[model samples]
Target: MDTQCGDLSAQSISNNYSTTAPPEPVHSTGAHRTEGDENAGGFGELTELPIEINERRPTCLCCGRPQKVCLCPFMPVRPLEVSTCLYIVQHPAEESRVLRTVPLLAACLPPEKCKVFVGRRFNEERNPELAAVCRDPKTLVLYPGSDAENLEDMKVDFSASVHNVLIIDGTWSQAKDMFHRNALFRLPKQVQLNSSISSQYVIRTQPTNTCLSTLECAAITLSIMEKNKAIEELLLRPLRALCSFQLQHGAQVHHSKEHLLRNGIYDKPMPTNKRKIKRMEQLVSNSTL
Candidate 1:
């Protein structure tokens, strides 16, 4: 399905929300450099050519995931078409992660529905499309703040229009910096999901029970807004499978910061400087989940 700006509506979506969707082809591009032929004086020049890595050892073909931790079988066979469109503003550093869930989420949705913009700050010059979407009145940014309203507790009715969900993909500190530096993010109304479910990414530690991975947050928010229980349950299958694979491969289970603190098992982290203390405080206090 091709997505056009201001063309999405909940009434157009099928109530069953289940249908066959053809797999979208994933493309990879890169360039390789090699030494050119030696000249008469035994001097050589560099040459560049378009190259595609056909080696099957590092990456799996079925899913774009690394061969070491493939979770294709656990993922849904087709994309779930919903009323809400997910706009992810991902940190540049997150793309290199071996087990990140954004790729899985992207693979599960239509290419146009799950748009990602990778950068630290966005403007009309650098990212005009994103800036325009952020300016939409129906768009809502999922950031927690004292003045922000709870997503589940919103007093207004949303059955009449489309919703654009903007999520920042990064760790606690990176997300904070992204949120502060980006003026476009401040234009939308702020909302948050207050969920009791803990994160399924056990290999990585989270600062609070309210904390969830980008995938987890997206799933929960969509399920609640669309009022479809199956969305959250089915969308999280890859996360469970990935965590299981890691655990079997000798990865230690990590407990959430809130759990460890409440049980008196977490050590009191001592900050060496005032800057470190502020960052730590922000992490501990962050509850955007």
Candidate 2:
């Protein structure tokens, strides 16, 4: 696999992500996608927003909900049973968006167990850490296959061998590109997320029934590997939080108060004044409460 694109994945910082809260989910639903909405950027607007890089809430371009509270866990978890090391190769575009679970998994997962490789091409020599695993006699990069394990049975052969699963986090097309471009897969046994779900990206739409968000994949993989239940909670929390934040923020932006109309969007520039900031924070706290 080309290692250059894979290694340089973490090229940018998540937008407005000052808090440690689990990321909110994005990717609007396809069922509700009207022609007008599709024209608004076809879910890319929701998925590509760098909402997480900043501490403020990210309003979904579709439903205007916090990416976390979009209310649809469209992405499903694809658990795999493996006997080697696991790595996730993500497309950089996935990282550019704040509501992305791929970036959060990279940030939160234990470094010793899980590793993230990002970019269009992964340069083996450029990433010594990934190279060490790639060079390992038993490393594997996961690609969807007809022979892949069935996740619905929740059957992870319960092995003692250190198994690694590399999940490519991105849209179905982008994921396919990652698969074709990388040379890292030749290292070990391959795996893929159980393809039984319709995807949980609430603000984006995917054509495949097998697609899953990055967090769901990671949560299932961890459950299979270490049998930790908290991973599920931790992984899904961000999505909800993001959804909730966006809803609140969007409401503020659309507030019918005289101040907005008089000032106009971007003209008066809503005061970032301390009092207003405090009011917004209080509102957020009260809503969550």
Candidate 3:
């Protein structure tokens, strides 16, 4: 996903810790020695030039944000205990986004409760664990489609056993590509959240008004699985703080593309592709209805 605040390009933080050795000092040869060195009766040794250090903005180890705008304070004092496990199948691009919400979602939950896998392809041979989870009857994939069951209306017995929830963290197009490419995703029970609430991730533009961020999706899924509404609010605390901080720091509030199109306020150029043009027309028609 290319989610970010203020149109900032994606920033990557290197995890490698290998230290580079300083370069060897240059020694003056007899032929290259200056006249001053001859007058001093000794070879003038060049002082070692100081190595330039690459200075980066100080970042918080926990939330992965700059220290000055750390979101740790907004996180829960302790990890929230939950029976439902979240498996976030993230796109490779999301790992480089600076203002992603996945970190916030993970920070609010127990380490084991939230597992992230980064890749576009998954199979039983290479991803046995994920494959097993997908085969389990208790597993549910949060994806929207004509066949997907509504999460709000689905009935499940939480007392029987914990459920595994698979969420694809990417743009709509990327997510759809992954879902279609991987047959394992179709094995799980497909589900969708039909909540009417608008997204709280004001810093990033969404495809539609009902579209939610990865964090919001997880929060709602967990709250429903655990049968506790409080989980949703707890998980969203850091996200709310993050948006508030960004808005205060000059980040504009971005409305959804659907909203802009419906109101005739969309200033961007219309798509040239016939398929895209039809999609846009459908969005405008649906919004009116």
Candidate 4:
């Protein structure tokens, strides 16, 4: 990939955003039904909801947030466009999430600069563009594997080389599964952020100490690679404000699940078999009837 730096210094910002909300549920009365209706005697002639409940809410296009929690006002005036490309392999499930950071990241960069590929498996045939970037010699995958090198330790000639940075956007387990299953990801040199700075994603619970939101991870990586610390602050402005707004409006400040378990503030439940035995027994008895 060519490092053709454009004149992004004069980029203009816009604040226009959509205002929409989840449609309120309208109810109608009908017969109730139970599970396993194929076996017969499942229908109940009682008043019940006839309409299917739709949980998905309308979102603002600019911020990709629910109208109520839209963070467009807090977004930066202009995105800090960089020379390096950011390839985000996102789980398809993440698209419907109300509170996601990918949109914010997208808003900060040009479409070509930040590319998102959504799927469970990223094969060369399915995603040729992503595969090509992964195959590039300068490309690096941001992961904390045993053989991973710290971001700061790996020196790069920015002017001579434009790196294709691969970031997997998902929960810890989902990301791990994607990384393990995807052969393309395995080819790139893995890099990790060794800095001790804590995550500012207060609205969501991180899994571990090193875990970060996709936006935060990308911002930090860009800041380090571009040698401009301002990118981190610029990208995070809306995120921080989003968390603050949510906190003020009754959202609790969440701690990582690991932190909660370690501090004894919350306990990990027993194994699935032990925990669900009673429920399973009751379900079996009900089914027999």
Candidate 5:
């Protein structure tokens, strides 16, 4: 994916939106020395390598910062009443990757109110409350238009406003699996999102036209239900994070001319040969994954 710029180096897409990411940690000189000897161990698999360091710091995929320093004020430390509580169900496999935005949404919505669960089996993580919500009889799910009831004809107690939306978070395939495997039919109202905006995830591909990243879909659906007023800013924050991550990772795979900063590709500053040897040796000795 690298676009050649004289020489090749991984350019991170994160920098594009990292202005909002948390600040880097400040480690003392003594901390580095103490952690050195123990760090030198085994290295073999490419997947095992710590890609999150040097090129990839432990930045929040959503906020683009170390988890400890999440500065996004919207990250819902508490449930700020925006008329809805997102039931964000995630596929466990996705937790390892940075693609999903539901976890990041925790920063915007009430951490406790915005629940997350993952697994092959649903009963494996059973909760009376979750079951109640979907089955609440009063609750409504937004599935595809064909099988779903019309949104316009939807009738709710408008005195408070219709707030419940079951957001299934993942790739299209993953979402479908949640629908079938989990007996989403039991849900109050089935929702099928008809979205115009194409997805923005660059690392992975998905079905076109009818697809959207969870964040984009969330915002669109919320905007429509709220009459395009409530919680718009909160929804947009996660959307921006996704764009930034794409830019960061895209650059990492393909170094742009302007972003070339001589990271420790070579151990020493001047000579290329000796530094190359040392870097290789260090890479070999370091414990991966």
Candidate 6:
């Protein structure tokens, strides 16, 4: 229930960003001069040499964003103290994404509370720490399936012991592949959020309306495990600010695929495979109920 992160004024937030784009490199025509040109007393023929410019934007070490769009101001001033630990199994691709949410999730929690392991494969010998956590009785994996237990229905005694929660960070397909390929992931009890809340990550499209971002999943799980409902809101404040900033800077709000299909605005081509088509139809049917 701790909410100590202070807020910044709109004017102050806007002051950090520059409206203009980076200046383009200017080309110049000049005689090429080698290292020893002056000693040789001769210059190469006139040639147009493009001035090399370091175009890489200055990045903020804390949030891993360009200085202009850094989310540090919105982030919790200090990491939240929590008993439950989060183990994020992130796909390799997620590291390269400019707008990924895993960094945001890590920023909100204490360093020891949030640990990220990046890879598609994991084994006992190679990943001893992760393997050990997977074998722990209190460990639970956040994955949705017919066999998965709803996290809300589970009985947990927070005062007696802390829990380690594992979350997969990737696209739906990537996450599914990781779960099936890694046997260690299946060692822990699988749990899913049974909330009806829609995702607030407006900059990225989700497979379904019920689908939440990696950060959102972690926020909800942490709140439930810590027995602190306010933790969810505290974790989400930065995310909401990020999305709002993106929308103001020409980013469009992305609707979920399910929402697009239901509203008859889905522009993508239908699958040619009959089974795929049937599955899509079933999804559309279920959305109505």
Q: Per-model C-alpha lDDT, please? A: 0.72, 0.51, 0.81, 0.72, 0.50, 0.79
When 2 and 3 are scored with TM-score, the better candidate is: 3
- Writing each residue's lDDT as its tens digit, candidate 3 over 1-289 gives 2222101233555544324333443555655745654543332222233334455777777776778888899889999999999998998888776678887888888999999898999999999999999999999999888889989898777647988999998888888888999999999999988778888998888877778899988888888878899999998888899999899989999988889998989999999999888888877776421
lDDT of 2 by residue, 1-289 (tens): 1111101112345554333333333466665655764565635445554464434565454333355554324322432222334477777776565555554444444455556677778766777777677676545455556645544343545465575566677765577676667776556556655545444444433333234566666666666556666666666665545444555656222221222333353244555889755544543343210
lDDT of 1 by residue, 205-264 (tens): 777655788888888888888888899987899878877877997889878776775667
User: What TM-score would each prediction reach against the true structure?
Assistant: 0.74, 0.50, 0.81, 0.72, 0.56, 0.80
Q: How would you encode candidate 6's per-residue C-alpha lDDT over 119-154 as one tens digit per residue?
A: 999999999999999999889999888879999898
Candidate 3 global lDDT:
0.81
Q: Evaluate model 3: give its TM-score.
A: 0.81
lDDT (10s digit) by residue, model 4, range 245-273: 77887889877655665566756563378
Candidate 4: list runs displaced more than 4 Å: 1-61, 66-68, 272-289
| lDDT value, residue 131 of candidate 1 | 90
Of 5 and 6, the candidate ranking higher by TM-score: 6
Candidate 3: list runs displaced more than 4 Å. Answer: 1-54, 287-289
List CA RMSD, all candidates. 15.3, 23.4, 6.8, 14.2, 18.5, 9.4
**C-alpha lDDT of residue 142 in model 3:** 91
Candidate 5 lDDT (Cα, whole model)?
A: 0.50
For candidate 1, the 10 contiguous residues with the lowest summed lDDT are 1-10
**For residue 209, what is the lDDT in candidate 6?**
76
TM-score, candidate number 1 = 0.74
Native RMSD of candidate 3 (Å): 6.8
**Better by lDDT, candidate 3 or 1:** 3
Count residue pairs with overlapping backbones in model 6. Answer: 0
